[model samples]
Target: MAEGRSEIRLSPSLRGRIERFLAAAGPALEEFPPLETQKLVSELYVHQMELHLRNEELRRKQVVVQRFLHRQEEIQSEERFRSMAQTAIDAVISTDERGRIISWNQGAQAIFGYQEDEVLDQHLAILFPERYRAACRRKVERRRFSGMVPFPGKAMELHGLRQDGGEFPLELSLSRWEAGANSGYTAIIRDISKRWALTLALEGAAHKWRTTFDAIGDGVFLLNLDYEILQCNHAMSDQVRKPFGEIIGRRCHKVVHRRSSPIDGCPFVRMKKSRRRETLILRRDDCWFKIAVDPILDDDGNLRGGVHVTTDITTMMLAQEALKETLARLKRNMDETVAVLAATAGSRDPYTAGHQHNVAQLACAIAREMGLSPEQFEGIRVIGLLHDIGKVAVPAELLSKPGKLSELEFGIIKSHSLMGYEILKRIEFPWPVALAVLQHHERLDGSGYPGRLPGAEICLEAKIIAVADVVEAMSSHRPYRSSLGIDRALEEIFQGRGVCYDPEIVDACISLFTQKGFSFGQEPFLILSPADETGAAQGGPGPGREPAAVRSEETPVQKGKSAAKKSGGLEGRQ
Candidate 1:
């Protein structure tokens, strides 16, 4: 049966040939081939079994090859992950569920000054300072249980510790991942010391600028293009009589003027339009302010807004006005006093009634013609008005004598200049009015009375007065002589130029009366009293006569000339 089974499994062609042989040698083969056929069939079955075993061994080897390839691929993926972490500029670290650092990359070693081996198995809290470690552990534990991160997927600044026990600022970003059954956290950290320092420096500068802005004494307002107040200092708040919060964001005109529109010729508007500085003086509630507006510009040279500074000048303006009023009052008082003194002196002697008045008017004109300063002219005017003030002491007989006086009377009359100096020297005056009075009779050639001061020694005011005195004396009727006339007066000064009178003064006096048509406004008359008629006939002192040293029309000229002639010449009089 087994031989038959083997024959049935043969190829068709072999089976056909075998069947033919079996038919031919059927009887003969039956006896010899039965054992051979069974043996061959059994050997074929054994070879098939060996081949099946080899095939099963090859299938087992193929399974081993597949597993080896899969393991190699996993190792390459791990190598790539390590390469990326090591080369990253930021520190990379992985912590286990307990917050223990399981993996530390080379970047972590560089940033924290630690080796991978040193940080592994250590608590991740070791990267934070002791003060922050407790808080950090609590936060990590909270995240683990609640599946909530305090700063997940976000970078946060925190204090970090280095291997050398130093602390620095760092930015940290955290994330969570699952490694099989264990949950872990990955942290990316970066050193931020330079950036933090820069931020602090900028904050410091801004603080300094804010401090300076508030320190100004003048009211300062920073305004936008719309004239709205954007920022203001304490002074501005005080100026508006409001708090800083209330003043800000309000229009400047509304705050300052209390109106919806700007004031006329608004400096802020002008500054914006012109892109330049503008200034104006404003008065509000009787207070004055000097307001200055300056435009602010951007980097591109476009107008941004304006800065308004208002300075209070009310006190200064009030002080200036008060000073002007005071000066005017003082001038009025001085003029009234001068007029009274001049009238009193003129009243003492009827013969020289308007003598001082005429001298003063001519002296002022001469001074004006000479282009003397107002102060100089004023001094000359006052001196001329009071030139004969000392004549109050002279006897009226000596003052109004129609004939030449005795030597003693002339000496007494000449003392009037010295007396005038003594009376006025003690009074404080802006100019040398007293000195000019004392020196008025002094001639340029050292030829006049009281003191025969030379031209250089005499003041210009005295020189001008002396010339005016001579001209008026000669031009008017004196007690001793009839009017010498204006022509004779002018000729006398012209002849005496550089001798007794200042040459410039003589020229100025001449020019005024000749070219300028100068005149004493009103002429004065002597109202002779009944006592004066008798005293004039007797040529002696009368009831209303002043004391000895009184001035007369002849006192500064004729009497002086008479004394000079008797003593030889003007140079010899003193």
Candidate 2:
């Protein structure tokens, strides 16, 4: 056993100490046995080698424990990374440099409708549309997958193919990793079908709105309170004869109206103040423009801005102005013709030269005082002016006679009313002038005239003229009679009120003479030259009566008689 273990080496310190002990006790222990000494050295050397072997055994076990612990930590780290990747909302996929799918997480299965076992080792091109497959293949060939490719591509939008063969839009982010000499790629992908559709819908709606705005034919624009043209349609450019570049963002008055500022009473100003629609008619150059401004409001009912619409109305307005001018010219011509006709009739009886014309003035005044409208009174005036126009048909001797005439002459005098109707009925007057003329001598009780028509059958115009006629006839001087004065003429109508005349008209006539200052001369008359007078006479006493002196209360009746008078009383007069 000693020889078997004798190969064990002695420690340097033990060998050195044993040699020194022998040297110090030189020959003192020479008597000790060689076998015992060899046995003792061998035992010591064996123990030292055994201790070093034991220490080496413990170190080997320690290395094994450290390796096992480090391996567990690595396993835990891998599990943590896998758990994070699986639960992510986006698809997490891994592929080799060959572009074959190597790893698939739960999100990848959910997004692509595939189990993890279904897609491993498959080409990554399966996830992309056919059009994008070739581009991805090209990127893979370059071994630099970035920017719209599979590796290190930051959030790029691309088409994705699902297990169902349906294609949809997706957002993808890419990253690459290296394991030894080989590389792998990870892609984070998100389905964006709803988001993409929403973006497209918004764009379509905006395009449709702009199209509708450009379809209007009239000039239309949006305006703010400051008169800035916020937006305008295509037609607005045509109206102002400018391009959209010049008009938009400029003031409306400056762009459209060609003014430095808004004009007085501008429709835009009015619309803002009133918060309602308003219109303005403007004449620019040779054209007429009608501007319609409508208000725009906020949801809270506050005035925000306005919409201005413009229309061209030059043709219509110009026609109206021309028609008005033509009518005026026609009226002047008619007046001249009427003057000539009035002068001709007056020549036949000198004393009543302006009688019909003066009757016209009084009749119009009475019609107004009675609350009659302008339409009613205007007709009355024309009828009164030409009331006695038929006297021209009667003999001068009969009309100018000083005393009451024979029954034959009286009948002839009464025929003048019918004759006046015959003369006027041929003309197409807007009013019933002819009928009123024939009924002027007619009474309410059927006690007078060529027609014995009662009050109800008489036109209101004829009644008004009758009151004025009687008053004028009795008050003015006539060749056949002296002036009876206005007091008696007024008394005549008052006494005949509701009997021979209309009560309302009588009251209106009285009010004029008493309450309102009315004189027949207040109106202008058609006066003929002395050359046209011929046998016409001036105002004075008639027949055997001397000229009456002017009384203090001479009365408007005397002055009015000069406006209209008959040769005799109601019994016989023209």
Candidate 3:
């Protein structure tokens, strides 16, 4: 038993020594099997070798994968750069230090109409027109002085030569860079054909506007918010007696009116604040101008300045003022003539003494209500006063009779319109005043007595006077009848609208008398023109007399007596 115990102690120490030796050698021979070891130790060594082999395989695979990923990143970066360069609208070309073409993008192909093969390795001067080649070389030399910025955002107008030898305008921006020890320039060029055309058109429009402003018979100016003269045309300069350059930057009041401050309702100031137009009479030292100011706006509709257009109305206003006296005299003479003529017609029939004068007053009112132009309205007023002047041709005995006229006498009265036309045709007035007299009896639908003119052909002025004439004739007392009320006169016109009178004029007249509460009668004659001297001398009413009678009459003795006095009035008017 003691011998067995000693053997056990020796076995344990020997096993511990064997385990230490295996641990020390395990790392160096991890893949190799230990041939001198026991079978169990050899089996452990084989398992460790298999695990080391698998780890080595996995490390090799990881290294291959990392290399592939780095290469993929480089390819993607190149692709992105290429895409950006291709999409540009301007031509981009790069050249080597020796001035030979290096990289040509698609934009370069489009601008110069040259394929990459045609331009690559060629001189950069090939893209320049012959006329600009020398200039381009000087430009290239100047680039050395400039710090190289990228070839864009710098606009320089230049000429480019296409492959077909045609030349086009271009805007170029250039950059110089170093790549792999080679110096080069990248020129970005854009064709400016469309832009140049638009520029030329804008220049032409500006020139036309300037020409119009300068050559116009009136004055024109551009003003800033402070009312300084920003621009003035030749006419304005002439008016102010100053040179254009001298006038510019000077206050408008100082240059024009010799004043240091603005006047009330200053057009320029009003235009700036309101962004609208303002018109007023501008008085300078010796000139009166109708000046209009309009605001100038930018592309975004921002107010930039004011434009002032001035029309010289001094001469016109002076002429109107000068003619005042002559007009007054003419008016007085016309009143006397109308009264005498109207009274002569009425005197034959006492009951109709104030009929024509009252009609004239009513006709003038109707003309005002119709919104007729000033000239037309004036013509109506005159013609309304003298409308029945031709009735003097009728016999007095028939006119004063307090009974209905025979058909023959009535037929004769109908000739008054034609007679009036013939009587006034020789007088040259600014208006066709005689035409209004003749047409006043005509109708819109061609249904009235006389000329039978239809719509539009019946002048607006005539339509108004016609309605007034009918109303006056019907409302006033006649020798054969009593006075018809205003309502009856209106009903007559209302019934005749669109048939005997213009609907608008009839409606306007109705509105004036019925709705507006305007009344007529007992007013003196508003004479427009004189009667013949032969008619005037026959014991007729004088100026300021009431209206004459409604008569279709004349006396042979009265015609002979008035001939001389009527001739003098005609000569004076002429």
Q: Pick the candidate with the highest lDDT.
A: 2
Per-residue lDDT of candidate 3, residues 1-574 (tens digit): 2311211222465567567767866877554455645664765566567656766666788789898998898689868856877788788788766556887888888888899998889878788877656555555556541332233446578678899999888987777777456687877788999999999999999999888878888788888777888888998888878997789999998887678897778777778778999989966667678989999899999988888888999998788778997898886887676567667656655533455566567777776776767776666666666666656665655554455555666556667667767777886666666787677777777755576677678776677777787677656655445554565566556656666767767777665554454567533323334331121122222233322323226332232112212322110000
User: Candidate 3 has what TM-score?
Assistant: 0.48
Q: Could you give candidate 1's per-residue lDDT for residues 241-337 as a string of tens digits? A: 9998788999999988888999889999888778899999988889999999999899999998999999999999899899999988987899898
TM-scores for all predictions: 0.60, 0.58, 0.48
Count steric clashes of candidate 3: 12
**Model 2 scores what on Cα lDDT?**
0.77
Q: Candidate 3's C-alpha lDDT?
A: 0.67
Off by over 4 Å in 2: 1-218, 256-261, 285-288, 350-353, 368-377, 392-397, 405-419, 438-457, 498-500, 524-574
What's the CA error at residue 545 for candidate 1, in Å? Answer: 39
- Is 1 or 2 the stronger prediction by TM-score? 1
lDDT of 3 at 393: 66
Q: Arrange candidates by lDDT, descending.
A: 2, 1, 3
The CA lDDT at 87 in model 1 is: 91
